[model samples]
Target: MHRNQGLYNYLNEHSWQITEDWYKLVNDEDSESIYSTTDPEIIQSLKEQNQDYFQHLHKLFIEKEEDFFRDFKIWSEELAKDQKHLKTPVQYVVREFMNSQEVYMKYLKEYFSLNKDNVALDQFLSWIDLVRRVVNLSIYIYIEEANRNTLRQLIAQKEIINELSSPVILLRKKIALLPLIGDIDTARAKIILENTLSQCADLRIEDLCIDLSGVAIIDTMVAHEIFHLIQALKLIGVRSTLCGIRPEIAQTAIQLGLDFSHIRTTATLSQALDRIIAD
Candidate 1:
């Protein structure tokens, strides 16, 4: 038998034992909550994943001269997307990979101690190098997937926030209330303007009560944007009523020489509703 084949047979025979040892090592050092599960099914699933990884790794060792293992690469990508792995802290995943390498190296050392005459030093070194390359590839794929998942979550959160910030509540037929709250930066103001116009057109809102009681300040540019938003609503056949303008915002608007003569103003949302009801 070839020297490489002998090594492969040894690894294949002891694969289960190595997997159990690796699991024990990871379970004992479970600080990141990745493998510290009480559920039997979860524990079994983790063992299965580890076993699959080792099996793929063993195939690579048997064919060390190959440029890449397409099957293993595909499996690694799928493993990266696994919900359990995705939820696991990345540092824990990295440490687990390190732990597996250490286990395999220790097993190889033990195997060669008794059969040192059977394996060449160069072949042993090559196997160690192959293990290192596979671990590195797995780490790279895991990190890339984690980053992509994080970015997706951030985008989802932003969309939810935008929807919440510019909510158009329909209080009556042909009437809606848009209560502006918190700080309105340029980006948020733009979102508010676009969402408001789209909602008004969809709801066929004839009168929109825009309350600014929650808003504390508005610079000239923001004030202009608000004015432009109102003008845009008018063009879309929606009459926008400005309400709850704070003293500071109104003063800024005056300083900018913005004419609010054509725009209807209300002191409160209830009063705006009352006027709409009375009219």
Candidate 2:
């Protein structure tokens, strides 16, 4: 007989009962948690997830420790990525895992009491150790995966914001407006340069007015990128005009020794457009 045969049988028979007990005792007061959800579908999904966890967990009694933990890792990773669990506050999720640990501890004691003659002290202690190790490791893995998901989301959002920040609007036939606003960091400037070039090509822009009136600050690197963008536009058969060059930005450009002799400049968007119409 397997060393933990009786314990395995006991857990298998009581799996549903354990899941029900866990659901009844769960604290879902946090409004951010899926556990606090009112939708019947979500609630039912939550119960099913709890039951699934128990189905994986009870195998520890019968399977080799290494095999059980390997399977548990797969299960834990899935939980970390679960749409409902991901939306839930991490604290609430971890709290439920701890609660499940408490339930396991309770059942361990009951199982021992019913079979004390056969359950040795060493075996009982080993099971306790295994339980604690699994719980701690599960929490660690969940938090690690959760952090990765958050970082992915942040990167995706930043990409969208970057695209939105550098928009090229068509002002007229074969003419377009590239309006730059806010602080121009080197990273953002690179995206602007790439996006502006792509947009000008797509719009078949001949005369491009880059408006910088809304921009509050510019560093040397950003100033360089702007010139690079204008030079890029010229290579793509687009005529470039710089408008609304603020005093601070001009000073930064001058300090960088940028040659503006060949560059077109205007004090306002209206003036730039008027110049384009006259030409």
Highest lDDT, which number?
A: 2
TM-score of each: 0.88, 0.93
Q: How would you encode candidate 1's per-residue C-alpha lDDT over 6-36 as one tens digit per residue?
A: 6777788989888899988865346546688
Number of colliding residue pairs in each model: 0, 0
**Candidate 1: which stretches are off by over 4 Å?**
1-3, 28-32, 64-66, 69-71, 255-261
lDDT scores in order: 0.83, 0.86
Error of 2 at 215 (Å): 2.0
The residue-by-residue lDDT of candidate 2 on 1-279, one tens digit each, is 224988988988988888888888776777888888778887788888888887787888888888888989988887778877777778988898899899888898899989999988888988888988989988898889888889999999999999999999998899889899898887898899899989989889899999989888766666678889988898999888989988887887788776677888999999999999899
Among all candidates shown, the one with the greatest TM-score: 2
lDDT for model 2? 0.86
- Cα error, residue 227 of model 2, in Å, equals 0.9
